[model samples]
Target chain A: MKSNLELVNDCDQFPPNRDPSFLYRFMVNGFDCPFGYLLEATVNTFSWPDYWEINHDGKTVKLLGSSLEERNKQIHDTLLAERERGSFKILKGWTSEIFSVYGPQKDLVLSIPRIAAPLFGIVTYGVQLLAYQSDTSDGAIRIWIARRAKTKRTYPSMLDSTVGGSLPTGETPFECLIRESAEEASFPEELTRTKAKACGTVNYVCRTDERGGGELGLFTPEVQFTYEMELPKDVIPTPGDNEAEEITLMRVEQIKSALGKGEFTPANGCIVLDFFIRHGIINFENEKDYIEISSRLHRTHAFPTA
Target chain B: MKSNLELVNDCDQFPPNRDPSFLYRFMVNGFDCPFGYLLEATVNTFSWPDYWEINHDGKTVKLLGSSLEERNKQIHDTLLAERERGSFKILKGWTSEIFSVYGPQKDLVLSIPRIAAPLFGIVTYGVQLLAYQSDTSDGAIRIWIARRAKTKRTYPSMLDSTVGGSLPTGETPFECLIRESAEEASFPEELTRTKAKACGTVNYVCRTDERGGGELGLFTPEVQFTYEMELPKDVIPTPGDNEAEEITLMRVEQIKSALGKGEFTPANGCIVLDFFIRHGIINFENEKDYIEISSRLHRTHAFPTA
Candidate 1:
């Protein structure tokens, strides 16, 4: 009964996801529309086109499919023009953060965390893009874990943004992604050039209190845009500057092995890695073999099966 | 037979390839060093391993099947170990202007070209990174080009490098690339994460001044390096403030078409596009074919096949 944009505007609006603490910029609509214009009440939560199903809440759920939908929306017509080509849907979403507003609006300025700060303090949302597979050779999905700088201020030495940075201010999640990738790698800024398209968004209430009280322990909710970046064999994980220390390529066997060890850290890297390995990006040579990295985290959400 | 670096230094160099006129920097070694640098060189030139040829000078040359013996003499096992696994092989050379000061260092001071400036003249050289192809889809050779700014004080809007630039004082061409990509794209400084690997060298001369008033035209020589960057599809091409007016994605098909229509403009862009297209890094199906911009002049060089 209502448009997706209308529904997006209904949800709590953040300039880049509305949280000042987070450092990323993202755009909402085709024409660079303002934040909060798309009410959350009108749009559906989101869903992976292929594996979407009903939840206990009995409402359609979407996650990691926002970018996917957005991608499809852009090239749907052109792709359909080529009958032989298979279609990939792109989903869009606003991954926002709410920073506490204090002091006078006139003199007060916005800021982002030192670790997440963009060249400039800009906040935004991104559209998650993804691709699906049925029987890939790897069997297990591949999770790309970005090894953080050992000396990082937050989430130090943990994997973050396999999909990339948070949304940038005054830009859409997609735009934020273009910026993120540039900052992250020597990659060309053409987002749609390769198979690295938007897949969808994963809606989850992520709370990070790894620091205990105050300072780094602040709690905040986040909507993550999952993007699909297909790494060719030659593309080894080489991190850029302090943003990433190294990129640990993960496979499912390692995930299972780590979970068995029972030493789970609060860092979300393992969880995300588990998702990738289960989804078939990473290959498991032997059902019994595993990598040497930690894998003790519990799987909060297992990949959907057909 | 001089050492590879010496041979590279002895070969024609693009003196104009730098800032502050007369300062020259461009050389490439044809040998594989230990340290796995071969792959890095290969990746730098050709976007894919399949697009490369060991005996690049002949029809028998093939990628993925080069024997160690077939590699250039400069390539030794020790050097090979230093190379990365997926790099490209580039061809570098110098211009005749560099030779003018050859016998001994002539007191030379050149200014680097500036936009509105009392043009800063710098000794600039022409370095071309080569991306090899089999001959056609099954076997033809090709290269890439960048449409230059026509109003440029030196080269103007001619198609210069598929991706190239002059070296500033004290900076290597590889470093120049880091500066170039950022300058061209308005990209963040972090994007220049990867280094450009030295491929090989080319020796040739260009006739500059057609006036023939005893003030002979500037003779050109060059040295090019091949750099590989696995860019995300979303990266945009924003061109530098002084270099390009706009960036256009052209394919070999378009180049062939243009060549057919008696419209051979700068062929470098199409040449590089052909390399990437063959490697599966770029797809013409997703990009718009070349559209008519304006009539521009282009040059074709015929060097003995190396």
Candidate 2:
């Protein structure tokens, strides 16, 4: 069986040999607020737009649009042009939904198309909720697991958390969790609002490879605000949207088996492992990599966060 | 009120201006396994014992003793001599207990006196248990807080976790927690063993200043195996030993106020802040530094851990 640490390593693949010189810092507001990294190749070959400035000496790239709306339009036009030229396959999954980019002081710098985030090596945010039921008699816990629809663009047909979604530009994590709960799993809004407990966050710096269905070698630092909801026994979750194909309640052992067999999405695997650690299921006594796994789940990002 | 992040920064004072060249890597078994960092001043000025080798060119230091016993003895004798000379104030609080030093692959390389751990800039392990009670009707949570004895050497009369103790060389975290739970709080072994849940770990790299009651400018990277226990309302904790002078149950708001006022021990403050975050008392929407605090609580240590 694959160790929990191994499962974590599979997702948090920040290249160890990454060279700072080979990547350009994504600066905002004329300050040294670096929030993303852009590959040298992209900097050299991509068609130059008037609003983007590349500084060779400083190894930095900045948007020169003077205002948020102007910057957003500049990026949108650039990506649209790139899509027409078929320059990057990742742009094929264009998510018009914008993701807010924050500066070093947690100020909203600008918003860009969601799919374009990885190209700029920007940090993204999401929310995930693990809904479970407790059998009070024996104290056995069963979790509700969802399988992504085969038609989904990313990680299609993969096992996922019961309720998970990306945080749109202005939405808070809790708000996203509530919306995802109803939209993805048909979970009641009142039940989720009252019962969902915001536990903590899970952070990892991942690089997209071919397996991730993106342009390879792009950094995607993510912060996931995690939550847990103890569902009542009488409540059942069904597929509320086409995003999920099915929902099933699995015992802890079954979940562990699935995790060991690498059946879950990489990030979801990390979220579930974190859940196991917090609930005392996988602890220092039994898990040799308990310390390493716990620390690795919350890696300190090199760049500023929202 | 001090921000939670500011409270965290108080305990995790890893010198931002730390010059790595001024520190020597502690090697083991002829490998470049750097488990600790020793200041160059200590290397150049201290009396050289035959068992310790300083490689100036490689910027490394190693224990030349052939066996674990020999290595342990070498460290013990050196510390004893230093204590006699009154060379380091940290040696005054020397506990006879030994802490295991691990290599890069997590193998036990040697054992050193507990108090001498910071002298070598080694990573130390401890277990902290936060005992709490939940009101069934209103769902209000209250925590049991401990106050150290006024005569204690380190942070005397300061607030502390309900049960906490260092991990001796040969003991696991859980084993240490169980022993400390009974010895420190007069808590029953059965209740602890059955109810204590190993939630996760909190890690930080701190440097001792005058306020910490140790030799100034010594590095202390620590890993705390944190636990949570829901105590029965009828059960009360009394001082089982002189380490803790008194124990009292404080509501969550009271604990937060204490944390804001910096009444708890620095490390204990971090542990309590972690508890608040995990229990949803401190969350993303309400706290501005939610992501930063969550990630900082589990800082990635720069050395190997056992």
Candidate 3:
């Protein structure tokens, strides 16, 4: 009997009838437990170093790399070749180069393609800012949204928030918000750091890179720290980088229609839902799952048990 | 592999080395699918009636009662007897005589013991209101908190919010708030119905009532709609009933200290945490799990598909 919380979290995203044994916990040093899972097929082909143990008896494999440097280099090259081979399309410009290695208490940042994260079931974090007009005579909220450039390998030309980007290694979520605002929207640091209120986040997991086929892919879990920044009535976002095709202000109703049409990234839709709830645009009486949807956006697996 | 959402929702409340099969789904009429799971031991004993079938092949059971009235009565009597037999301890004053039957769409209300809900894995909803000072000089918030009456059946003498109650049969949540506020805190209707803003909810499932012995209990899933009401600095909460021994104003720091000492009920602790996050008292930078905790309070299983 799974908890209601777990059932909601599951979202029926996993393929039914999948064998649990097909995946093994991807354990890192000092984690005592796995942060994520690695496919058994991948493990069978790994030429482990003498120090690393393939503990089949314990029904678990240990990545006792000769050193952190050695492990990073191998995982990096392996995933990079897979990407170059067209195994999984990587979103250019939007890609996070520094991947996170989650330990028991703290996380380690290594220079690796973010697209390669799921191989070890490692987690990722990002920032999505909802820049909007603060005053509207009609009591309607208008948000500045961007459309990803068509050149993007994934979700190209999809609608996104005013500003968004993956969290670079060693940057705080707030700092990332400031940097991303400047890169994506050409916003000044003062307006972003001062007026951008830290709202919350929307998180979910997706089964990634199925190019290896049946029962083989990386599990990518993500957490995005969200912000709500007010834009001066006359201010408009001009793209500072080529990542966005266009940035424009749209009424909440228009955005809602776009969401219904699936014009936004699934994650972006969830963030807008959070936005509606926070801005008093949605209430429990109107949406039965209002509470459920609001809370589900913030579930954190950033720290997995050992 | 579960979605990161479900993984975060799980929070692994179960004991180590626990068997997943110990739990079974709790289905209702037309819900053909599982609402949640009950302990397997409870299901093996039911000589299910004609309309209902125990689908051992699917490793689940179905509840297809002829009518809500009939099903409600059966589950009610069966659980009441279990309680009388001392299978588990009942909270003295907090027993819910009215039971809730949630289907795919709307929920049905029936007269049944609320405490018996977990035995069948039913999910319940309640309203909790936070009455606070309208103005604060130091930006330090003060709230009106109540201490439960010592003579109450469940969680006697524990700390609670200013006003809280189960949603009565046929009452809207807002109506329930107005009603409960008057009943619990002698709050004025005009003040509550007009000023009390529905914030959101905090949801979780816990295995309470340790009839299985030593850490094992029936899982109770709950969703509480939280509210924030502003009170003039001169106003005070006078208990309208015996539910609380005292209702007094306490600084947020005092509540935090009480939470640290475990003086508040487990559920109240969660409600307060939600309050802190919403009020901007807790920030993502300060609390590592702040965003995670903030979002998890609202995961709902209301619309489980058949």
Q: Point to the candidate with the largest DockQ.
A: 2
Identify the runs in model 2 with alpha carbons over 4 angstroms from their true place: A15-21, A55-58, B15-22, B55-58
Best candidate, TM-score? 2
Candidate 1 vs candidate 2: the DockQ winner is: 2
**What tens digits encode model 2's per-residue C-alpha lDDT throughout A149-212?**
9998778888999989999988889988999999998988899999999999999877788766
lDDT of 3 by residue, B151-202 (tens): 8756789899889887755677789999889889988888887778776666
Interface RMSD of 1: 21.1
Candidate 2: residue A256 Cα off by (Å): 0.8
Residues A59-147, model 3: lDDT tens digits: 56665555668767766665555555544443223254676664545545234566556556666778889899858888567999999
Among all windows of 10 consecutive residues in model 1 chain B, the one with the lowest summed lDDT is B290-299
Question: How would you order the candidates by lDDT, starting with the best?
Answer: 2, 3, 1
Of the candidates numbered 2 and 3, which has the greater lDDT value? 2
Identify the runs in model 1 with alpha carbons over 4 angstroms from their true place: A1-141, A161-163, A191-193, A208-218, A258-306, B1-306
Listed per model, the TM-scores of chain A against the true chain A are: 0.43, 0.94, 0.81
* Candidate 1 per-residue lDDT over residues A1-306, each given as its tens digit: 322112222221221212332222222222121111111221232222432232334222222223434433432332233222321111111123322111111111232222221111122223332222323476534545555677865556644544366554345455666566656654456633444653223332232243322223122333444455666555544555567676556565554454344222222433343234323222122211111110111101111100
What is the alpha-carbon lDDT for the whole of candidate 1?
0.32
Model 1 chain A scores worst on lDDT over the 10 consecutive residues at A297-306
lDDT of each: 0.32, 0.86, 0.66
> Considering TM-score, where higher is better, how would the candidates rank from best to worst?
2, 3, 1
